[model samples]
Target: MASTVATNLNTLGRTTFIKNPSFKATPLNAYAKVLSKFCIIPSIEGPLKVVQQIEQQGAQTVLETVGLKKKGYAVKSHTLVKHNLATGQTGQVTAQDVSDAEYLAPVTIGSPGQTMNLQFDSGSSDLWVFSSEMPADQQQGVQSAGNSIFDPSKSSTFQRTHGTWSITYGDGSGASGNCGTDNINIGGITIKNQIIELADTASSQFLSGSESGLCGLAFPPLNTVKPTRAQTPMVNMISQSDIPKDSELFTCYFSGQSGNSYFTTGYIDHDACGGATPAYSPVDSSQGFWEVKSETACINGKAVSRSGNTAIVDTGTSLCLLEDSLLAALYGALPGAKIDHSVQGWVYPTDTPITSIPKLEIAVGSNYFTIEPEYFGFADLGNGYTYGSCQSRGSNFPFDILGDRFLCNIYAIFDQGKCQFGAVQRTSSGATTSGRPVDSGTESSTAQLVH
Candidate 1:
């Protein structure tokens, strides 16, 4: 009577409590609280790399610098950390640091791809490739074949799907164009017939950085892309194969700026997932997002539990932020904990004594894990006047991100293809599925197939 996918659960069957039958499906479609914040409705869009840069900039001095000028509008500026590369894959924390590796180069109508990384993004649904269609004036500082733009003409999988796709990010950055196919090879996993949302915009505003193009990881209400002037990330991936369709969820490791990072598919590594494990909460199918049901939050060894809150596991977000009153109450437990609330939210002073901070724990699937006290301080918080704290956001009610900050403490898996998250606690003990030990702590596994 058991499904083949259910049977393939490996050791996780006995380890995780499958109290909710829906867990076997796809990721929990919890309502995305920030859905309305998406004024620019994603046609499809959008973390980390904060460590080595900080060390090179002098970790102490970097923390103290603040004063947001008119450099530009920033939706959210988080201190990105690091996540490790899977077993045989070689990963570089910062793209520049890995000069020798062959990065993914997206082509424009004008020429072929020059250099780029198979960047992994779960934030928005649109994908852009440098294009030759762009006016000659805007294409400076970058090189592409004359009128050839890194054409996918050579790849057998290459094809142009008619439609104009574009999307603007919360940060105001945007990209647009048509759709194309290519042989996407990364981490040794190749999706030979991968369908890519090729946004060959006449302009290159969004395509001007270390990143080349993005591989979207979101599943629904999100698949807006259409052949008739619309396209979706799900549509493209689904067309490629049923692999993405088999599951109900998809996740991004979202490791910040410390270690190397990559896009993990098929299942979530148990050990990589962090946060406390709480009693099984109900899933709100209508709400959307892989929303988990949690009854309360445990703050610093105290019972500061409450209900009606969802932690969004977005690869798009770089930092973790809880509600104001909740964070205050939580930080209230710490010594000399003064909150800087000049902005819509609050930020903790870096000089605050770390010892005074209580261990904050979040209970997820079947275990409870504590978020490191250091991750809470500003990148410079807790260090003296020499280091400056990083920027933060806490305006959203009951908002907390299970991002790289928390993930670094453990190995996690986003079984987005399936609605469940297979997390391995005590991963440092080496419980791994990638043929290696769970580098973080305890956890690791696989899903039959989904997304």
Candidate 2:
């Protein structure tokens, strides 16, 4: 059944369309012969073994560095399309359903340029993708899921840096590959000689999804590549003078409804924020992740006390993570909600009434963002709860995770230059009020941030 879900992801990837021409990719079969020929670069049996050996070697010895890149300067913005991959295991997958689960953007790589849908992550720093080295069984989703393997052998400008890279997620999922340099293009903006991680071994989690790779948008200090660390595509563009110095920051706005969600590089899209003035908070980039102060949280007008609570605005994470103490206090107001060790979080009875769920609001600086009941009830446990057995929105993590589950309510901007984060209400799509009617007293007619 899990493999079937993975297969469905592949089918969804191939058929998804992008509104932008630059990020549009050719069909997989269109270059099958070329990719097949390139497959000879890494012998099938040795790829995974090589990756394991590299991991065991402890640290990599610097061999040699090649090519001093020329800088290109210009202020520009490329609009990215948000793609949602559907897996049938979930109930009634819709634009809103998966919007909070995963967010993917189309990226073009190599000379002839093959397009791959990659997750834009703000927590880590390393750009990696499925490549010719991926085993056949794991590459099943490549064709239908819009998952494409990068074949450096086919690109005229591809340069092998002979470096190894590896990344492991908090859930123990990981990928390892060889590093190289290639031309990467997004929404017509091109970043020449961008570092690319070609995965030779991928864990089952990656193989089971439509995302072909990840574009880490966080600070460069978090990169895991070996020999020498590689810069993120965004950092490369910014440091190499590829984007206008004045407009180097990027902004992301995710809308849960049919309305558009976009990732704009180099500038902010004010219209996407629904005309709401952004309330900015300083981010602590010294630790690699986009860390910010989450002053406090309130439930039903009662304040929840927390000490030194900080938040990491991570788009890659599907659910919001909070400390165990906060989780207890937050879910205490709701009936039938208990910690489910099996899922590693709190779960509520599927039959619990929506009105029984209390409102949750968190403060960032002086601004407060509220999440309604509909957004808080995460997913239904398949054992017949349908709408009743939903996971608690809060999970136990070392620090607070402001993930897509909470982020989709506002337009989020990460300004690398200013070292600050800003968020505003998304205008086109109605804020947190979903499926349920809004209470006239607590809800505003127009979506906007409150102090």
Q: Against the true structure, whose TM-score is highest? A: 2
What are the models' TM-scores?
0.58, 0.69
Tens digit per residue, CA lDDT, model 2, 1-451? 0001111111111112222222211111111111111111111111010011112133221110111111221111111111222321212111121221256788999999988888787876778889987788767756454467888888888899978887543223458989889998875667899989999888664665557788888887777787787888777777877655555666776654443667776665544544455767788876577888875676676655454667778776555666555566667777777755333346667677867776677766545676656567556666433221112222112346676657776767787877888776542245322111122223322221121
- What are the root-mean-square deviations of the candidates from the true structure over C-alphas? 15.2, 14.7
lDDT by residue (211-280, candidate 1, tens digit) is 4455444443343345442333334334555233453233333233333443433333333433323122
Best-matching candidate per lDDT = 2
lDDT, candidates in the order shown: 0.37, 0.56
Candidate 1's displacement at residue 126, Å, is 3.4
What local lDDT score does residue 32 receive in model 1, on the 0 to 100 scale?
A: 15
Residue 295 CA error for candidate 2 (Å)?
3.0
**How many residue-pair clashes does candidate 1 contain?**
97
Write down the TM-score for model 1: 0.58
How high is the lDDT of residue 9 in model 1?
A: 32
Global CA lDDT computed for model 1: 0.37
